[model samples]
Target chain A: MIRRFGSSQVSALLVGLVAVAAFAATYGFDPVPDGLPGLGAVEFPRLVCLLLAGMAVLLFLQESPPHDPETAPPIGRDAWMIFAACLAAVPLMATIGMLGTIAVFLVVAGRLWGETRWPLLVGVSLGMTAVIWLVFVKIFRLTLPGGWLFGG
Target chain B: MEAFLGGLAILLDPYVMLMVLLGTVLGIFVGALPGISGSTTIALLLPMTISMGPVPAICFLGAIYCAANFGGSITAIMVNAPGDPSASATALEGFKMAEKGQAGLALGMSAISSAIGGIVSIVVLIFAAPLLARAAYSFGPPEYFALALFGLSMCAAIGGDSALKNLMAAALGLLIATVGMDLTTGVERYAFGVMELSDGIGFVPVLIGLFAVGEMLDQATRRFGKPAIIALDAARVPGMAEMRKCWRSIWIGSGIGTFIGALPALGATTAALIGYNETKRWSKHQHEFGHGSIEGVAGPEAANNAAVGGSMVPTLALGIPGSATTAIILAGLIVQGVRPGPHLFTEQPTLLYAVFASMLAANIFYLVMGLTMAKFFARISLIPPAFLWPSVFALSLIGAYGPNQSMGDVWVMLAAGVVGLLFRRAGFSPAPLIMGLVLGGMVEETLKQSLLIFGDDLTGFLHRPIAMTLIVVTLAGLSWPLVARLLRGVRGARA
Candidate 1:
């Protein structure tokens, strides 16, 4: 028979492990000068890392509430698709620029989320892109990468 | 009085007043939308507010905070959906009122009670904040460190049902706060050779990712069904007789809301909940509660709106946030080069007073807006997730990128979004983490300073009367859950 751990238990253990690693890594921080020495710079992170590890242990040992549903979030295919599109915007903006990336991401995200009408998707995406450009670029005078392909 | 008058003078400026008006209108629409919260909206718009300069920016955000709580009751009354978590209690009787064809009465009363409660809390804030600031004048490093810890200790009770998870999230926040170069030692801790990380994680990107982008991802996963909504019964807006019946409930809610909101970790949601319960307990028409009692609609609406002003007190007076929105507002104030604390009363009277006056104006603005255009806002609650979430994402993208024009910030934002989702999956709240992140540096700095002052003696904390009192409270708070659990076990055995 195999014993299964719930997502909460697993997450707790993972965070605990990370806290331990974070504490160990703090050893690499630069030492405080001899003149001013109560708590060093690394002391604060170390304190928090230890607290995190302790809390993680407590969380791991804690029983799951019987009334509650499964601990894992209900991230279905569409949710992942939306996340992927958002992540892809970074590279797409680098390749095709901000406006182009917005349009592409919108169409892809819209389709994945079940917006079937091509004209509506394209029109809305275009409108969003135009609004973003006007507000971010024109009005606020903020910069988005013009893209190497767009020749700045 | 001088500061109050100066603030009114500033609020009278056309640009400042316009920002308040815009913020009130925008807050209502967003707050009436189920998924978009005031916190998310403020986060998405934070970077843009930079261009608006400090005064207008703060006023805009303040008005939004004030109006959003009242706006939430609009949807609760009409569609049985709470646009803000603070309005959940309102839905109990508010939806019943709607179903019984009394939505207009509920809507009108909610607005009226909300305005009254909000105005009452603002008056309290005007008198209370400076007094708190005066009290804080004698506080030293040790006292501040203990105070910050006391603030963090409340994390175990907030966010979600799981105390341990909330504490863990707060710890993660503290760790994140250590990312920047140490002010005293001038050594980078967590930057990992990234230049942007040396200044620490940007608050705007983290907030945008956590609230906006994170919520969008969550929204994409779930499907919601449209509930039967009641059309506005315009002819029967609450008359003076109804007001006579509800004055007691409204006052109870406002008092509870103001008290709860002023507490460090407590916020509008908690205030509204307690307000509902208390109003139910004290009402003359207790039998009418679940059957569309007008007092039921008025109580929580007033409480939640009142909580907006209540939450501002600690954020302004002590450099500690009272709620998530105020945390974001505190960040906005900091980015504008205004550090909020006891000194702000003396150093930035115009800014302080402006906040007070604008919040007062916002209550009036929303009262008028709610009474007149509630029908229009009621329809906006039905916005499809497809159109809404994507637009939010697009705006979030610009918001994260706009501040420093740094792509690194955008990447950080995306990462925070992922973390936010993971937090939800683990049944952790992002709120405690935010509070910790905001207060972490202060805790670390004050601790170090205290240590230096005490010649590295750990027992020095006991010598400071205020610090000692705060630490005692913090310890009691941290232990209460365990003690209560033990007591329950004993009682079970007795049974």
Candidate 2:
């Protein structure tokens, strides 16, 4: 039972529920104000929030199945580092646009992934930056920000 | 018939044909990338496609959708990871084939089955859509509500071993759907007072954050080292005997896909799983299913491709989305000023024909692209998680923010990513939740409309012949699982 409702899963669910409730409370009972005119007409995003909350509850209530902890693969420090890096990326991307952030992120990330050749790392990072810019900006013509530091 | 020919003439225009070809090739590359679903590719391309002529845009999008469904299998076959949810079943056998140095054969089978499924679905759609629309128009509000009920009920059919969780997820979706302003009363239920909350949450950011960013985070947390890329064998095509063995699974998969695709909410993943399980039940070596049987690869690949065609039925005929990708496609239709419904055929026969021809054109392109690009696409699995995760993260951010040029959407994407990560850790799928959110509004509106029209008389709900038939069908569908379980229990007791 302890294994099923591990500290990680429980805390995650609790956090999610609290966040959802807070989001709901921020606007009071009237969640959507600009909704299309009529009674009971719902839109997609609000529905997603509600579903996520419900899923959190359901997940919390679920009885944990038994498992042998020893047999499961070890969650290594390296994995955690990767997780930390991913989490940190949101803030970094917010500060720097895709090209600058990704270039730096890739070089560091590539080394973490066990790439030994510095030249390969630089080459790959530059190549990826070019491709993303060309495809998303040049070919597709989608608006991708370049941050305040560089002209978008 | 004449309309179809005219549409075909338009599709045959060199520029349109070129767009279809280019779209299919691009789709294969995107689909080959792990965690890049067909829907995301379409969403990303949508801004650009908006400017193109409607027929060409439809053709390009159709080609992309069809080819991407097959393209995901390339990575699944060459590596253990599924490129998209629909290819998850294929990865079981396909990756095993790669492990055994038969990667080429697995790739060949997936390509062939996908092509067959795509072509068959197009043929079915070309004929079945008009009839379905005609019958659906005979439906009153009550019947439409019943149809929504049927779609919602199928949520129970998704994922592994948790009908309760799926129901809970869907209910949560429906409840959240109520947060926006009440269409009838103009009162908001859960918005609090935030101005942004007034319009409700946007779909693109949420989708990008949940699926793209969430997936990258999950990949980051994996304990094992990434799968090593096996050296490519230049020539390793399947033998005739292997093709003969998989033919049965392919046909069964395609049939299941077409059937489920026609249903409003079931989508491709459901069809693929059902097809995979059904084929396994009929196979001589059923025990080998998850252990990497070729039948498993063939069935799922076929079903998923066919589902692409199947999911389009409602979108084209009724202006309803049968899946997430179709929902996005519906948005595109609205952007192009084409209102899809019962009157579409009469009001715009050439447009209808154009859509049909585009579907056919996409199928042919899928076959060509899948065959030529399989080996190259297979290489995507080798990119280290460090590089892959950050890049995908960047794309997720850009894609989420691109729609409205809002930094707020980017933050929303971040929040959704966190939520998505939590859902993954708890072993609950976010797919059904996402699907429910996309479909929830449509379902609720139809139900309320029906109730308003019928007043307090419950039996009046079934006054329409089509409505009565749909309600009965929905009831039967809901009871199917319980009935099957009971039968199994009874047989076991006797034994």
Candidate 3:
């Protein structure tokens, strides 16, 4: 029960901090231009921030019910690993080309999800990447990021 | 009548017909995949619309929007995986029917009822849009301000677990919307010296991040296990007896759906939930609810599909989106240089009527296609999440990067995906946030303009009857949850 309440409290605190940051950010905003009448840009955002802060307090005051352990599973290490691997592809795509990066990312993602058949993994990854490339890059004519490795 | 014929003529063109058919097929495929929403599909497809004519583009997107609503029920009924949040209510009784070897019956009921509901709502749209557009012409900034406030209040009321949390999420979204240069004063608000941030966050990238990548992240954490393989009995279309039994629920759901969908900020998810509850309450066989009731499947399925047509009314007439999918469609219209307002009805009657005709055609096509392909669509749920989600992730990346061809947008998508995952884990919903983001600019501009007109006397707004009434409605809506809780407590104490 305390753990559940703690989570709620943490979220409320985060919300409150965001509200404060929003209010604080208003200090940097230039004043409404001369001759412009009634309620500057800062006023509405400031009002929203105050309301947000008040709601954050109200949210904190409300007691959160205990979570059912059976239903709420703990985040596992593998999930974090997968998330990190996915995020890593962002930078990697800039190094390797789009098609190459996607091919590698899919194979790695499939492996992480417990698909161990190398032939199946390679075929699916390369096949899907090619199709997406052909459709999006070729047919749609939308520009995709071509990395330095591709000499674009 | 001439304008309607011109619209029909445009749709009769082979190219436009092909686009509509392709869009419907794509919509069904995407909607059958769990966690891939129709709005996300539209966001991904928005760039492709640039090459097409305005009529065919809007018509194609409209067909997808209409068909996707019905297609979501396919998986929801078969394997209990709701392809969209709006299909959750359908999944409750639908999976039960599947367990009882009546999957075909449930699917058939949903498909037929959806067609009925959609057709009814389309008829309403055809009649109501012109009237609504005329009324909308009289609306000034004050009225628009009040309308936006009411819409935002409804978002808090209908979304997430708690109203306070929803408000906070909306506030966050509003703050995010203020990131670029302030439109009013010609001064930058929160660009933080980044060149890319000057244009504000790209809408498509953020949408793809929130809906597609966020869902992928959530799916990654869960164990796939083995797919539930229910042996589908013969594809049994519901007979006239079954249809007759469900007609009342279908009509009631359609009515509720059409009314709610015409209201700003309330989407198909809320409509489906309310429709399910109302149908159960009025049902003669109420005990059959949650235990394979045909009415249960019909109610939500009909309501959700009906909402697709109903949502188009405000999008076309008032320049306000009634749902997220319509919001993206509105963006598509704006991109096509077709502003959605009263002028659209007057100036682009052919385009407007084409959209209406396409929706009608899509509804008829979906009924035929759905009945024929119900079993095949059901098999889609049997695919492992392991393989499916990775492809979704890949597609999300391409979608985020496609529009601007910018790595900056990709980074924004990644960051937004993280924020989305955190929001989900904390019991806060992204729906209200999305609503805030979509409405934020309109709210700010209208409020400023209203204030300029009123000249520091905020109470002067009370003189405007429509604006005042909407403000009052917003206040009541915001307070009703608290008032209901207090009344419940008092009743409990007295008892």
Look at candidate 1 and tell me the lDDT of residue B463.
Answer: 90
- How would you order the candidates by TM-score, starting with the best? 1, 3, 2
Q: How do the residues B222-292 of candidate 3 rate in per-residue lDDT, one tens digit apiece?
A: 76675575777445679988888898899989998898888887778888999999999889999898789
Candidate 1 lDDT tens digits, B1-495: 887899999999999999999899988988998877788878888886788878999999999999888778888888888988889999999999888878888889999999999999999999999999999999999999998898788777666757788888878888998997999888889777878999999888998898888888777777454556687735245788998999999999999999889888678888999999999999989999989899998888889888888989989999988887888888888888888999999899889999999999999999999988999989888766676788888888888888888889889899998888777766788888888889988999999999999998989998999999999999998899889999999999999
Better of 1 and 2 by lDDT: 1
TM-score of 3: 0.95
| Model 2 DockQ (Cα-based) | 0.30
Model 2: residues with Cα > 4 Å off, grouped in runs: A1-62, A67-98, A108-119, B13-15, B39-57, B91-102, B234-247, B280-297, B324-328, B331-340, B347-352, B456-459, B468-495
Candidate number of the best lDDT: 1
Error of 2 at B212 (Å): 0.7
Question: What's each prediction's clash count?
Answer: 0, 21, 0
Q: Estimate each model's TM-score.
A: 0.96, 0.83, 0.95
Docking class of predicted structure 2: acceptable
lDDT of 1 by residue, A1-152 (tens): 11366656777788988899889878877777777677878878988898888877777777755434344546788878788899989878888877787778888887877778899989899998998888777876777777777745
DockQ of 1: 0.65
